[model samples]
Target chain A: MKKIFFSFVMSFVAPMLFSQSYKPVQVNFKPMFGSQELVLNDSVYTFNLKDSVYIETLKFYISGIELLCKNKMVWKENNSYHLINLSEENTLHLMLQVPKNIHFEHIKFYLGIDSGMNTSGAQGGDLDPTKGMFWTWQSGYINFKLEGKSNACATRKHEFMLHLGGYLYPYNTIQTIVLPMPAKTSAIIVIDIKTFLSAIDLSKQHHIMSPGNNAFLLSQIVAKSFSPWIAPSKK
Target chain B: MDSTFQKISIIFFLLVLLTAFVWVEETAFKIPDNWPKPKYDFTKNPLSENKIELGRILFYDPILSKDSSISCSSCHLQYTAFTHMDHALSHGIGDSMGTRNAPALMNLAWHSNFMWDGAINHLDVQSLAPISHPDEMGENIVSVVYKLNRNKKYRHLFAASYHLSSITGEQVLKSISQFMLTLVSSHSKYDSVMRKQSLFTNQEKNGYALFQKNCSSCHTEPLFSNFQFVNNGLALDPDLRDYGRMKISGDAKDSLKFKIPSLRNIEFSSPYMHDGRFKTLNQVLNHYTKGIQKNNTLAKELETPIILSANEKVDLIAFLITLTDRQFLFNPAYGFPK
Candidate 1:
């Protein structure tokens, strides 16, 4: 009688524990600065703008990642902020843990640090002040950083640096991006920098250091530029 | 078996009681009565006597700067309500002039934004501005951390306060914030009157009425300032070309807007305004009545001229003097860690 009762308990408890454990899903991000794929410091890509421009540096934050199934959030990564640098290839891939049996139909994330984190004191890891993404002059993190040299720019060395970040209303630079996931467990999301740069008149509005209308507009464009690649899964 | 169970229960109860005692002793941030809840969320960085003492030491230490000559105290002196007296703009390391005046520091826990432009939204990270500014400390956080780690004094303090093996930039910043958070200035003559502990003089009473009629709209009561960014009709400084809040928000509408400073220690924290343009209360009153430069972005309240007679100005100045909290200005606890 004792053995039978023990077996019955194990049958229910074992599956419960197994269901609690999650499977790791790896998502790869590919950043393309125009028609060509982004290669930091390679200087092979040209701007989609009218003038001849070379892409040198492209780094931005992707944070608050959430997995949604049937329009309901199934899982969300804690401390999901990631800083993706075009020069660093390893940062392009992110592994997110999700419930084993749940089917995640969509992925949602912010292009910049959320206001809650921004107001909170100095944080560690990707949000650390040591990272160049943080602005010492201001308290907030730089959401998107795009630096390059262009013939159209009138400044010395023909350089343009756009450090966009602000958490206030009317000039809030944080942008939310939602993408439909493919049937595969793992998928690639392409961030086409061409769509963002093409929309901006770089020569006229090259230097965007502070948060404002320009930063807000650029953030919106960048948020819309991300799409899920439907190619066959490697696994 | 019952005896054994009772003994174990007694031991557990004693342990819990001891832990609670220690926790209460460590967390001792008291909110003053009749004041709004502080804007700083203290749950993330709990206050402790050791951490505050460590922070006080850091605030006075020049080692945080590139050259070990300039400290936060150099620009912010406690006696003069934590503002540099007799300087139009803040003088930084090596006598470098900052574009804006170092505003008085008091009641910082109530403040959500820092600097004249409101660039820094959090008090915890506000110190980073002066620490890394080329004209200010001219020292990076990486170097500051390295310096702190090498110093035996800081290492010992960090171990005692944070129980960490090594010093970190976050620790330094948060410690300073803990110290700044304790600077609550709620013991002025105005506070006495508000609490009905004392009566305001006839002149002060009249001035309070006038202040309510004119300045109270922006400089709200209890805290004495609403702490919003508003263009107060000061002409743009041609040399500095500081667009104030506009530079941070990138909005044309926010041009010339600066954070409204608290009037807790107005007498000591002068010359006034973002640039320290006014040397006396008389000048400030005169500007409000006569010197308002009309512009599109000027505060709507100031657009209609503030009418103040010479006698009324004197009365207003008298009321402003009531805001001086000598107790806070010379509080030994807030003074340099000896």
Candidate 2:
């Protein structure tokens, strides 16, 4: 059903804008709550009739971007690791260099860093251990970090810290995300955080700070929450 | 023999010798004569004199701590095999006592895991553990880099080592690793005895045989450790409540298991065990022989009872003393940079 919806929108949204045209790919990720852009800190949001939440931090890694045309890979970014930070507006957008005169029907990217970069010693730039994403206790990147306060949370100051990451076997939480592209040169991806928050009972499972079955399961749900931005008129 | 061929061969040999000299000068680290191939991959961050010097400075500098009150050398003193012998538990910033003993630092290039529980897999990334530990340095890597960048001497040192004005965690970690990989402790009298340059006394020889029969399975020869995690049947310290490997691995079977530390400089690296319960070598020997706290997760090597007479224990202690390398303890290069 989701594949049908993507193909249906594939025809209705974008009209083969490539036509062998050379252009740089621009991706802008939007973090959104239900029907509104997700604002950090100052804004109060009420959900589940009892939960009042405010996101203090939202950071995740987007890596291994690949553009596909007709279910075949056409372009892949090299050294493609980007840490999308809500606080840093510039970090949420990426400018990828695509091959000249190529058409891509869909866009695919990893929601977290892969096992290769995780095991390979200390890295520079976005993957640097100094970036606060890497785990000091263990050798792995914290693929996704969402820290905030919720009224439903019973802990001190009503805080919840979810640091999801694992590269080792049986607990590797890296997730692959694929979205249908609807533009020629630019794409706006929406990570509907509402879908994520609604899926889990944040009160009972608020603190998932390590790699385990909880992190692995939560990572999959978070991956499914990402989608290509659809026009309000079309929606 | 053709005179022309012989002349060409001599020239070629001289050229080879010159190349060897240049190559050796490029890298300061080398795998010892008969040691196992190092687990650390040097191709990623090759050794250099400037980087090692920078790393040594970082090792001794208190700038890495939150309040600049502690450095790595605080817990790991060079004279005592790079580990504090006085304290059983490592004390860090704010005089906070840590949960475990700070193990001796030596031959790090061959270590597969760092920390008592084998939490860190790579040596290059091992410094992150202590630098960020609240009880240890109480400083994050980002904050440390910020501190390093602000210091003029560190900036110059970093530039000299990496040829980059901007300091990153990778450079800091790789430089520290370069210095640690140079800590090769293979000059002990036991090593000399193995090389036939020296001979063990009759009592020492008897102790060696006993060590081989009883302890060598885990504390293997040459490196004096297989570097495998095993439960050495240490009874749980109720006050500390530390379960070594199980805390990291999250497996019931791994409970009470800890990495078999190398006995390279066992004489100076006293207050042994993960929690440093035993103060002297005699206490350790007593634990192995009579105090084995038989548990379901206990090491199989300890299943058999080890019986040592009073004289035999003395001989074993004598042999253990031969494992200490004064050169390593007193090496000026590894001491305060100045």
TM-score winner: 2
What TM-score would every model get versus the actual structure?
0.84, 0.90
Name the lDDT value of residue A166 in candidate 2: 87
Write one digit per residue (lDDT tens) for candidate 1, span B28-125. 67887889988988888889988898889999999989998788999999988899999879887888989999998988998888999988889888
lDDT of 2 by residue, B144-174 (tens): 9998899889899998777786999999998
DockQ of each: 0.36, 0.34
lDDT of 2 by residue, A1-235 (tens): 3444477788865556444544678999999987789988868777777778889999999999999998898889899999999999999899987767788889999989998788778889898888889999888899999989998899999999999998877888999888899687899999987888888899888999888889999999999889888768863
| Top lDDT model | 2
Whole-model Cα lDDT of every candidate shown, in order:
0.86, 0.89
- Candidate 2, residue A58: lDDT: 95
State each model's C-alpha RMSD to the native.
Answer: 5.9, 9.2
